[model samples]
Target: MKSIDPTIVKKKTLIYIPKLNRRQRTIVSTVFAAMLLLAIILGGLLISNERITTNLEIRNLSPSLEHPFGTDWLGRDMFARTIKGLTLSLGVGITAAAFSVLIALALGMLAATMGKRIDALISWLIDLFLSVPHLVSLILIAFTLGGGVKGVVVGVALTHWPSLARVIRAEVMQLRSAEFVGISRQFGKASWWIATRHIFPHLIPQFFVGLVLLFPHAVLHEAAVTFLGFGLSPQQPAIGIILSESMKYLSTGMWWLAFFPGLALLIMVRSFDILGDNLHMLIDPHRGHE
Candidate 1:
């Protein structure tokens, strides 16, 4: 065989693979993050029930070969309890986020498309909600609703919508002046028909991204209220309850009770926050170049 010339070998080494565009990279990253999140959620769901089973014989054990997160005072596996509580929290977060997004969409559209009086009223309401401290409002709402899963859900749903609704309102206002919207109106299409057919499609990305971004807030608030005895029931295996129970045992030198559960919750919350930020960058027309 003939030996390749040195120059030809150098040229071959210079061949290039095209880099991914901003959109393509965002798509890949988003999918990977989503898959990881789903895997964690599914794992938590699968092992949650099994881990909560109690055994008095093994109660108050420290971390060992048999138990990584140690045992609670009641002999329940801390790892199992943490995972189960996380799953419960994730469920609450998702439900609350969905409800909040729906509220945002409706109010956003109304504020953008309706008369000036309605617009000003919605704007004032948004400002009013934003002015209050988030946790305090959530506690009050949750308590008023009877302080359980329903209370938490309603509280979160009510509190999380204002920011996203404001964003949607701005987007709809822009859409109102677009050429297509004006043409549709000239054709005698009713306001609702034009909104449904012309404006709503453009808002789907904002809606979805807003929904995801609301999740971490919902989860955190749910935990906070529950920890304060104003959210989920104490008997339920929720992150808030787990952390709340851990507080009493921490002074007894049983550090694992709070450490594992709180760490897991922190990880889950941060993961969702990163996921939401990534999604916002992906969906926003002006972002994701970096």
Candidate 2:
């Protein structure tokens, strides 16, 4: 019988490991381009010395050179307000998503890697939270906490963690029985050391995709709560507040007041969603195949 060469087998196996190629590169490039363009526009607005003064004469004006995004009912510069609102929305979305994911990661890891009773308790809590209607729970929390930006942030962060926790729990559970985890256990490696050294690297891609997906939802939820009068104050210039105020002028045919803001919100949400999808595909080639 011929002796099999182990080195040759190892080399062949390693050669088959998937990696990003030209098509993946193109997709990543496109996504980055969109994000970069958005960043540039937002940065310019943030740093520009030019003030956007509100003019009553231009109030509710349609999109034109003088007022690119048109003017709001309050005579505020809609273009400037939209930029500022986008910044605020992005800030809240990123911060809330990050906080929620961190909470989820910590809780989920504990549940997956800790004692059985502890896991059971955390799992039960997660299930209980999931059973509640997220939006309604957020609204109640915001109202109880005294409605404003801070209230909205807390409410959204609290409501957002369950889904991420479930995802992380599922990932951890799948990983716990894998060969590497079992080997680490047999070697008496500390749980935290094994998790950090072996598990976290695997979890990072999924976590990032989750983070991106969370962004759009967080922004939308914040806007919705604000629109319903349980979130940011109207004077703060949030997109939701703008939309809420625009409702009164709808019957009067000042459609631009609502139209532009609504369009801006839709565009932003869609961008984030697309970015998330692209990221998911990039990070998981199996997903790309689908």
Candidate 3:
């Protein structure tokens, strides 16, 4: 046989696409995550409670085209119930995480900008909270508040701030020693003026990313405490309540009851986590390189 150039007689290859740059990747992820979250929350909330109302005639139905997630033993549509519960969970997460991020921002700035005594006290409090198990403190706080929506949201807000506070505090401490801040201080600028004009602007991205990151934790904790009966009431369409009730039927081969709701919750949490990560990368481009 005549010899042929190996490069000219190339083998076929599978399809290939170029890798995305950091900005491109971030935009894609952020858009997808934001849309997915928004659609789910809006779709879930827009559905009336009537969809999940009892209908004994359809009780204990399995998954079908009519009832995508099947019907609970009470004949309620599991899909509607899951969506409603997810909406409630989203509310709890948003409220709790916002409060938590605000608390973190305030305490962190104070600890870094204020004198040593204030820093010591705030640091001690941070350490104290960090030393305790999060779930333990959350359960205690929720129980002390009497175990309802208020209790759960408050508990999550209070318990989730310490770690984020520490991060913010360190960031502020570093920012305080920056050349521009020192020059501003030398130019007779007040702490508040410098913070608002310089430091606060820088911290905004951190605050937002921290807030997004906190959502998953808040949602998961709310569901956990509620499932343990230390959070929302059983009558409410809470994810915890749905899962808790499903447990009683799982043994009777009612797998869909638990499986679908649990899966939805997982997807919701994971989506927030993805959104947070993408936002962080967008805010801090250096992280994306890693």
Using TM-score, give the best candidate's number: 3
By TM-score, is 1 or 2 better?
1
Listed in order, each prediction's TM-score against the native is: 0.88, 0.84, 0.92
lDDT against the true structure, each candidate? 0.89, 0.81, 0.92
Candidate 1 ranges with C-alpha deviation above 4 Å: 1-29, 288-290
TM-score, cand. 2 vs. native: 0.84
Misplaced by over 4 Å in model 2 are: 1-33, 40-44, 47-52, 288-290
User: Which lDDT tens digits does candidate 2 get at residues 76-109?
Assistant: 7777777777777888888888888888888888
lDDT of 3 by residue, 85-174 (tens): 989999999999999999999999999888899999999999999999878999999999999999998999999999999999999999
- Score candidate 3 by TM-score against the native: 0.92
lDDT assessment of candidate 3 = 0.92
- Which is superior by lDDT, 1 or 2? 1
What tens digits encode model 1's per-residue C-alpha lDDT throughout 1-290?
98879998899889698999877877787787777678768878678465678789899999887888899988898888887788889999999999999999999999988889999999999999999988999999999999999999999999999999999999999999999999988989899998899899999988888878899899999999999999999889898999898899899999999998888888888777777778888666678565
